[model samples]
Target: MSGYLADKNICCGCGACENVCPTKAIAMGYDDEGFLYPSLEQTKCVDCRACERVCPVKLDANKGYPDYLKTYAGYSTKKEVMEHCTSGGFATELSQLILQKGGVVFGVRYAKDYIKAEYVCVTQEEDLKALMSSKYVQSEKKDVYQAVKKTLLTNKTVLFIGCPCDVSALKLFLGKEYENLFTCELVCMGVTSYKIAEEYKEYTEKKNKAKLTFINARSKKNGWFVPHLEERFDNGKTKLTTLFGSYYGYGFQVYNRPSCFQCRYCDKNGVADFRVGDFWGIKETDEFWNPNGVSCIFVRTERGLALLKEIEERGFKLFKTDYEKATVNNMSSLHNKAEKYVVLREKFARIYKEEGLVRACKKTESFSVKLKRMLPKGMRAFAKKIYHKLHDKKTR
Candidate 1:
């Protein structure tokens, strides 16, 4: 196996190694944090080294920002589409286009009653709804890469949307680019542990005494900037919490995988043809600013530009904008430095396993975090804006 990874922390858990193993010697095993790592069955190992050869961490060494062909800030004209997507419905719109052309679309979706996220394929327009919106937790690739390979072999069109690391891993595993394949990478901020997500689900279900029927982590019910986590219960009740005041908020602050802190894909030179993310700091005076939502789209490759042109011709609302201005405040795409929450994250994971989720959260919550959570909705919103302004100024 050529020592797939010397240290587990460096693995992005993309499952490329498992997918490329010829003898099925590699299996994905979970750590305490609920992130996957490759494990080799010594008895079945043939020392082929294929797993190491396909590792994205080893292959994506010359990574940097690619010259953007074009940039845009726009949203879908369809209100219903924008309402369900995380950003400006760009992904949903693109997926619909692929489906209409009889192509396959692969993306993350909830499984096992919303406790986990995994990649699923959809070939029908009606099924595209299942792959919409953001999934904050790390998603299990689970043989989807192999499925994509098989579909490509059939000369069928395929669109794969995922975090940058997953896209890189798929590219490395395939060993070459396919003309029929299209990839879109999300501007990621990092993914939280599934263990944390599961704990939160259990706590909420127990507290409410009901099953969670539906969850929208990126709901625009209260507007895009102040997004809320909307949860629907089986008993006809609903719960709405600010995205910044929920467990997801805590994850945003800390508790992502170790590799996320030192992400190699957080640059302009990504592996995907297109990069899409929230236009975080869009100003009220900007032409694309809408209370509904807005997406910052970067066309990085010729294929991406061609797809953008096709979508534009088909009546998608896209406005060309300055690349620097479009990405000025979107730190997720440019920031490569790891956060300083490693120690705190480790402590939280240990405490979470020893105690319960609530206690672990209470133990880790800083005074400022507590204060933010305690503030009223309006005050919290105001505080968040001020915080973002200061952050942008300092980072600039």
Candidate 2:
């Protein structure tokens, strides 16, 4: 075990590091404020950098997340772009363009049927739809490295879209000279657990006395869809879950992996030519409220900027607006939250649940719960926020 970046800008919050950690020293830990960050059982660390190699941040640490990381408001006219996207289908549109130009784009796809993540290769237009929308579950696209390596061997360009860690893994696995790999990470707001989905299925199908039909989860009215839910009934009726609905955050929290509380990868570190996600603040422009929502866009390089412009010209939607940062984007805010909560996760893994931790982190359906980042101090603040948010959301 070696040290690695634990902040959100770099950490994809993927649990690879925790499992790969040999000493079992790296138990998932959380700070008091409530956000989870990895605390090292320094004794377990071999300092081999095995954890480092798999780190999305350390792979391109300095360049991985830029200090001047800026935001952009871009869009797509393609109805499908709006329909299928979590935010704007910028990622999908861009990915399709890359594939159309004889390139391969790699990104996480919502296994709607399984409701888990499966990394897929998008080479055809039809494949693009499958990859669109946010899964909310953790991406276990471990095959990404192999798929990318194989795609790159062909000499065609390859665009890999994921959280920072996924990109970092590609760089680490392929060596430093991955010329054809275009990496894109999202402004991750932590991940939830698969337990939420699994539990939902179990409770709905087994206990609810009704056939689980479908989920129109999240509160958004139109635009892109988030973890939309659908529960069907034999009478042909269905029910939906709002973003702040009873089924999402809290339910997810109850089921997320124990490691999530001690997640070392929850942080977002820079690693893509272009970073993209939902542009949350703006209500849908002309389009209906995007449930999956608009993709929040950030360009860290000229290459990213150029791609944005090209995609815009290629007929994606475009708008100009002042961008903002949530706790998700502010590193200082994260550090501030880190203090009191740092070691909580260490204690938690012992109690969070022994066997189900890893399984829960991979699927948010259990709780739509995943790990969020914070320094020890920040964790305390997060607790207050969660208390209030949950209280407020639950009552509403």
Candidate 3:
């Protein structure tokens, strides 16, 4: 019964173990927090240790960070592509480049219902639109890793884009390096569950009496500095809620998988060829600063550097930038600190199960939060500042 659960709080739910299980013994099941964990079928288990071998958490423990290369702050010159993307449109540009070269590009996209995200391999340039923007929830890898291996074995170029853990798991599952495979990882903040996303959708649907057709979690509609959780309903009504004002956004930090807080991949050294994320905290005076959005790309391997050069040659805009200066305030790349609200998180989970998503959110709001909701827009800001100041002083 060699399970991958080295500890209660260690699984990243990358699905590498499930894909590698030779006898189909490992199944993914959700915990109270709605995050996935591997559940073994003891009767079917052959104890071959395939699951253990492919576990990224187990393999990455002793692995050192890869050598650093160069960093850049840039965006795509294509206006339409830049408009649809969450950041500088580097990912779309890169994916397009791979497709142009007859390579398969694997990326995360919302399922038909817009409630869950899953990895899909795109071979045509038209399908690249599905891979654009950001999906804040944790994605289901399913058997995509196996599919990727098959493509790699066929001697085809493969580009895989995912969170840091997912990329690491794919590398571990392949068990060896393949020159044809190029991996890119996001500088993740953390990931919530599919259940959480589904529940939130259900709540939104019930409130609006309409089906959810589209959601841009990092929408550029209100500009990138303060992105909105923009949702379009089947009834032709659209709702745009600021990230700070949304329950799902607030809960994302507090109710993520336990492994996320103790992440082994949130460092300058990384296992992927390229790391991509929003160039947060950029100043207007900086040369690369764009009011729209900009991406800070970190090239970690020689292969990544060459591919980046090739993309630039194809009319993609890229600018050299300092890695340390770019990422100094970028918590997504450097910090793995979890939200400090264990009891509140547990309470919210219980309330969510007993009541529903909307009620649970309302119940979890602090006194100050509730008060802000009742106040006017101007008063709300002032109230929030005072509350935070008092709370910080009290904590100190």
Candidate 4:
């Protein structure tokens, strides 16, 4: 049988193959694209093929989306949480519940270098802030599967939040379900490489003449509808710019891992106990909708439902909704498919490698966007308004 991890096109870089290798022969190493893939040392090979058995992609075909026990559109009642979180603060609240029970939370956060995102364990409420928002970049998961297993064996409750692939990887590594373990899969569209984030950091610093101290991929300071990237500099300066204006944000769809376009775990097909994402399609006028933010939650297992019940008791507001309504504007909440732009993405990757992110933007950005860039600052906003009006009419 062909090695699943050997095929770069299919590997989600979840590190399960490496983690599951019995001889420690397989290790995760980056490709030219800066995405991780399992590499084997033939000398240490035991030919055990443990990696193959644990591969999520290999096992994905037979497991379709199971019937969900309950679905809801909800938000945390806490005002402070709503202000800081990406969506309805469900993730934060849920993590708090686990921590309150003396359990540990596993989630993503930026490295001290601020160039890479890595999965880390948070045991205290004060440390939860680092893991509160989305990073958008693929996170490094070195040895975390082992750490999670160690914690679970202690009979403590654990909450693991990650992209579908990572959650699957962890579960497959354990090879058995722990009653105390709660897995929440973030609804993912795609994840870009950390290399892009590194380049964008340099680009931003060069443009602003200040080193970045922090970065938030999706900041809701302008409110939920108009999200912006927030950057803080060592010079004590702060900047909030539209996603389109940022190279990393604009190229997010363009620079995702190759496996993302052909993702097998999209929609409700994953192994997570529950799923969470922003409630996109619900209109502001809808009663379930919250102007601050709302999260679409899918509770699959009874354990997941029970957890939600406890959270509700602690002030979470949940309004029951069907899968159809919850995913109308946010199909990615249940389905993950990228728009057709394979050739453009390829071209962008080439330009990005040769000339850097700024040049890639100039070459790959849509003509309408390029035209807007050429317009004066005042007219650009006016043009944006007119375009949105026409777009809203057509979509209606």
Candidate 5:
């Protein structure tokens, strides 16, 4: 353990430091299920502690939450912002606001050649769209953070967005370096291990017989909970596929980072100034086709609230709605709730072994026939809602 990344007392293992390293010396690999951390080849490291400098929990002289922040998830905004936004499109909104103030924002983007996550800058409107949605994979966002640091070090404002662990990684690496970081975190859905995203690319490339042009994880046209894989062939044909049930196995097919499945900071990880995520479990009717591109948002701090207001003030359609509150219990962590996923670790491992990472959802053979019968959209929604409600209640 030559640097801050290995510090048991402070390391959040977001992998930002590994990504930032120029030598390509550090690799992020999982321990058990899928938590992430930097594994270093000591010979390559020059003992910079560069990874430690940006850690949020480490950088904040006061990294703990305030008394008023206990068990709260809803921010001032109520309605989902964009159809494809993983949580609400609030992060983009906030980033845009900061840019309007002549600041820079850092977040993840898919590379033009590969569907993997890469760090990026949001300096203009076009750049903002790229920042939308949860990429749901491990990213090598080296350029993204470096860009933000370069701008902020010159006293420019910056709104950095990522999962809680990502935020922690960034803050830790930045240590005592910059004073103008506007850090925001996604109320994370545990990250699928890095290998999942990487393997999906490999699988799709061979399976589809085409080079993928875009792979949207949260396509509204598809189900938000289901991953929609889009493949563009050499002939220009675009096709979409779904991964509804086998996210874990598919995610682990490549190999996950060690710390993912057994995360520690989920309940009250003070990794970000504000946390955001899909406000799931909200009730709505068919008219609320707010699907396809809207996101539910939570503002977890005063800065977050102010950023939301600024976003709305700039002609973005902002709506207020009601949301359900999340508890330490009952939420399906999926990836980075960062810890407590282990009680069922064996069960998960068993399921994955049985089905692999990218299996399709269990098809309802009877419903398959019914769906092909050209059932009306309203009827389909009603039927699906009933099935989902019953299913959820039973699971509970």
Candidate 6:
């Protein structure tokens, strides 16, 4: 209620306040740490508390986790779709279903510059490709909530996909849920800064000697179990490297926004009707185990269940699973905090303010990571195989 919408550690920066402000008094601006915070203009402010009402972080802080109606592991039957997506392609399947019903889908995609990701509206099936993979960076919402409400008011079906905080913010902004609107929140492990995303792009382009044309943070080309970043350059070249090899991915859990470290929505009862993410711990021996990809989904509402049923009827594969096994290797999807390296994270922020992300990550990286990076490619792969073998055993 102070002049700002919420303090840095509490604000998720969903931009609902800026979108809902009647006087256009609220503007989202980046602080020294490069995360967005609401800036209020007292001159144009009506003091109506519309911004306050739309803030999910402030309103839903004390909400308890709800019991899920069901849990499942699945993937799209289409090889082409599953191969190109970050996870099982269930989100793409849902978007396709909504589009077939003459509905619009809302998801995130890189901006024209490709340095930042932002919410985009997709009404055509072909356009869904833009939203295919995961973007670890926090996306800019820029009036997207208003656009979503406007579309829903027309009585058309809409499928909105985003992180749990974003889904909650949109629901709060609408003040009520419309039957025509469906939301699917991605099970998130927090998000990094635009500054880090931008710095990584510059670093990659500088090293590759060409401007970056495209990037997929979680490409499944080499298979889903192993994470990689696929990058394309204007000079007609493409590169695929391990997730840890990428600057943005290397600093992921360590350099997330202050609010993300204390995320309140990382629970079984998320804000969205359903939650979807990689089914990381599915064993090779399981019948539903797919090397191509598999998605872990938790249905929290009847509408979510109905959507799952429809996908199953339309040839998407679904396997009944329990929450415990489904979340085995992906506990960050349900945990509230990432407390691994608080001291190092603070040092990272301080170094980043002066030297930028690439240098900061290099300075703060663990000795093990540095050693792994130094290994020969073949040796590194062998080591990774051994690590995964042990990890799979632990999870099992």
The candidate maximizing TM-score is 6
Q: Candidate 6 on 94-135: residue-level lDDT in tens?
A: 999999999999999988767678999999999999999988
TM-score, per-candidate, Cα-based? 0.94, 0.65, 0.89, 0.92, 0.70, 0.95
RMSD of each: 2.0, 9.6, 4.0, 2.8, 6.3, 1.9
Score candidate 1 by TM-score against the native: 0.94
lDDT of 5 by residue, 91-209 (tens): 76677677778887788887775545667777786677777776766666544555666787789888888876677666655655355778877655455545455556666667767
**Candidate 2 per-residue C-alpha lDDT over 1-396 given as tens digits, one digit per residue, 9 for 90 to 100:** 346645653344444566456675554443432233556778767786666666654445345355424565666677656655666677878887787788887877656654456678877778886676666666665445766778898898998887655665666666666666677776554455554555556655654576654443432332233333445665676654334334444444343333333333333445567666654443323243333455557676777777777887887666544334322333321332242333433343344355343332333322223222222334433443455455445433
On lDDT, the leading prediction is 6
Ranking by TM-score: 6, 1, 4, 3, 5, 2
Candidate 1 CA-lDDT value: 0.82
lDDT tens digits, residues 1-396, model 4? Answer: 333454677888999888777788889988888888888787887777788878888777577767777889999999888888888989999999999999999999999867789999999998999998788889999989988999999998999999988998898889998888999998888888888888989988988899999988777775665456889999999987765556778777678888887777766777888888888766646788776888999888988888899999999999999877777656456554645666777898999889988898888899766664456545554555566556545545
- Computed on alpha carbons, the lDDT of every model, listed in order, comes to 0.82, 0.55, 0.81, 0.82, 0.55, 0.85
**On residues 1-396, what C-alpha lDDT tens digit does candidate 3 reach at each position?**
455544657788998989999888888777776777888888888878888898888888878886668989888888888788989988898898888888999999999988778899999988989889988778888899999999999998999999999998998899999999998899987788777778888878889999989988887776775556789999999987665567666566556677877888886746888999988746667788786889999999888999999989877778888877667556768777745665677787788788876687788878755654455545543544455456545533
Task: Give Cα distance to truth, residue 148, candidate 1, Å.
Answer: 0.4
Q: Which residue pairs clash within candidate 3?
A: none
The alpha-carbon deviation from the true structure for residue 84 of candidate 1, after best TM-score superposition, in angstroms, is: 0.3
TM-score of 3: 0.89
